[model samples]
Target: MESRDYMNLSTDKAFPKLLNPGESLLMSLKVIKFNKRNKAQERTIALTSTSLLNLKGKKLQRRMDITSLGGITRSKHGDEFVLHSPSEYDYRFGSPLKDQAIQTLCQAFKNLTGRTLYVWESNEISLKDLTTTKSDKKKGLNKMPAPETAINFRGEVPNFNEESKDSRGKRSRTIFAATENPSAALLDDFTILKVLGRGSFGKVMLVRRKDNGQLYAMKSLRKDALLESDQVEHTKTEKLILQHINHPFLVKLEYAFATSTKIYFVMEFMKGGELFYHLREAKRFPEDRARFYAAQVGLGLGHLHEQNIVYRDLKPENVLMDEFGNVYLSDFGMAKMLGENGSTQTFVGTPEYVAPEIISCAGHNITADWWSFGVLIYEMIVGIPPFYDQNVNLMYELIQRGKLKFPVKSPVSDNAKDIITKLLDRDPTRRLGAQGFNEIKNHPFFAPIDWVALEAKRLPTPFTPRITDPLQAENFDREFTDEAPTDSVIPENKLNMILQNQEQFQAFH
Candidate 1:
């Protein structure tokens, strides 16, 4: 492994062993780390790689500096550039080095490494031209190559025009969510800090961007599994929903991209863990504390409804908090976007939170969120859903019966009971927020809430999780932490089928 600064590259310096283009070399970079004040600098870069891809049979150690595969490509932010190939676009250099500048670096490579005629080595001509140049005798232009030592690659010349362009181009990106300051943050932009959680299909990983050291949650889903399980549409739905919605109380999709095998969604890291984890430990929350949490969720849901989005899944597990106790709604696998007066008859949602309309296979709209809100509040107050039962059918019956039964032991307030009652109404038309969130926001239960300040995150939370570090996983379930991450075993036949039908999952990127 070599540790060298790109700025200090000189042909006279002895370079590391030169290998074939595709051969995995243990690449490292030299960088200067400094505090926010730009003081106390350290000239070093981490010996880490963000890519999970194995080059052939060997591991490829990638870095953001020194040298990158993707050539310097223009960015939407004018001269701002991202360098890397389109296929294995591993590293995106956020800034520095341009066309002619790249030629200068290649000169350094030639001087240090001792090679002649580097293939696709010039910025003025396409890489293909390097291998075979057309002869034009009329113009008296001679086919001349750079003399002596050169670098060459087995693969075709990288499309410099589209090098920075990801699978999701600017137009495709607009199909999902719009961002004021869109994330140029690719999946490879962040190094995997830890495996946060994993399921049958994919994983939620803790990642830190090399450029800014900011932490985020990266959810990598297997495209093959999504296709095999017939969940391609669900995956697309989640991405589209996330792109359209953004709020402080809602988890934001910072960036999204996909590879041949996996799809990734980069999101804000909620360090406080799932609300269910805390609820299970405490048994239940007091009215005031529950009210505070519920209000935060309501604001999030209300905003979604305002955008004509219905959060079909609203449970404690999806509610996450930051170190400051600011709660956000995460996981939009079941959320759907409907136009004004638009509705869907999708029988989706967790059994407990599923509205009667959804279970009945009748068309449902934004009103469905109100019912989930009722179940969530009930669980917060009583530590158990109102219709808790060992039998699934019995639970469904309880929900359909529309019976408002409260535990005798619970000293529920009139305002609390009043809001829950209206929300859990069997008739979707009569439910709180049916007309809009205005009906629910005006309820006495949330009278203390200042809509503006709440949105501004001015209200003090009742509880802040004991999260001193973003990497701390104490609040999370040990089962997930302790379990070894199992690899996805996709049958070759299934993978081929998914590729043939790749158009179905196009929205995922």
Candidate 2:
């Protein structure tokens, strides 16, 4: 297709509105609907100003709100497309004019939502990309080239053990009996001090416990938003993991309680702030400093693995530092407990650090975390992810290719490069730490690290944050700390919504 084909395609002058009042038909094309259980049926897909309508002859089969769409994914060949919805099943469609269809949808979506409709390389879209807006255009959203890379196939590994037990040898529960009343008293234990960070689900705040007068980082999540995004189970998993795991390099959960409209997690406040902030300020860390941080994180991952849990999301942002500069792995929302000798097929993780197995839709285990570890090591020393590209699709292609290259100016040590290359191996079975994290700890790069001392956090850190006050969050982003620290008032009408779904979060305490 020519570039001009996508121009002026957002107007309804060329197509009439269909199915809805005041909705203009942006594009109409014949597509083959691929169903796993049923045969591929021919259908007409109409992209309107407000919704995407799938029609079989004169009957409408499905109508998806354009605003509800998470993103779009195109097959390596321009013959198939997948419409991703945040709250619904992905709709797969095949068409000879797939390129035209994608362009039309992107243009129309951008025009209607005032946001760029990202064309993901795979169906596993990152939550970060799903919530991105046009303000991220400079980061190169919606700028992928036509599909040309060959798709690699891997057999799906089935996990026979469906559920895993906790340290007490009891099956984990998603919803438990309420241990505390859902009232204002739930939050009265902690005095809100400062806003630490904010996200789609809720915000993290610095708080002081009224009973002990100890400071903590309280993460508050909205119940309605959790139900809307279908993340109730993941939230429960995070709570379960936090309650069981204890390590010097892992953030500890001090308390967990929920109100009628929100769930709260009180954790040890890492005064040194996110490693991302420090890394950005320093531009890049020296090999010695990077090794110091990597060793702690490796131990944290090792502990989680020993408990049969996988820390799938490991990045600089998720790694926080204490006042003494010791790093701790935070955020267990993406972490999961796998059964013995079992793997999961869930596609979740930051795109830059995602493993090749995850991108291929093959089952993945703890080894996936090793791949992210390698990416983090490379990024720490080189100042950017090795496979990073402005275009996300091209980045994924580079990741699958598994080519290792060092920057010409960055003087990475031979040992560092060796460990990174071994971890970035395309085959998960051959990847470093596949057998165990002992292999990683014994690597020549980490030879200087004293495992015993590091695990106990007795080793001196390379950097220590200058914290002037225990209550001040000078190391955190000012954008968040400057905001009001009060919890949002729930509307009287929304109280009914919270009551209706109270059972879903009964065990949250």
TM-score versus the correct structure, for each prediction:
0.62, 0.69
Error of 1 at 243 (Å): 1.7
Q: For model 2, how does the per-residue alpha-carbon lDDT over 204-305 read when each residue is reduced to its tens digit? A: 999998977989998998886576445788888898898888888999887788877998988889999988878877878999999999999998999999
* Whole-model lDDT per candidate: 0.61, 0.73
How does model 2 score by TM-score? 0.69
**Lowest lDDT 10-mer window, candidate 2?**
170-179
Q: Total clashing residue pairs per candidate?
A: 12, 0
Strongest candidate by TM-score = 2
| Candidate 2, superposed: residue stretches over 4 Å from native | 1-185, 491-494
User: lDDT tens digits, residues 1-509, model 1?
Assistant: 24222322223132222233433323222221222222222121222122112221122333333233333333332212223332332222211223323333344334334432133233311111122112232344433333232234432222334323211111101001111224565655778766766543577877788898988888888776565334667777788788778787999988888777778888888888888878888888999989989999998998998888888888887898888887889888777889666798766676667788876667999889899899899889987777755333345567888477777787888898889999999899899888887778899999988888888988888888896666656667765555553433555755776678778766654
TM-score of 1: 0.62
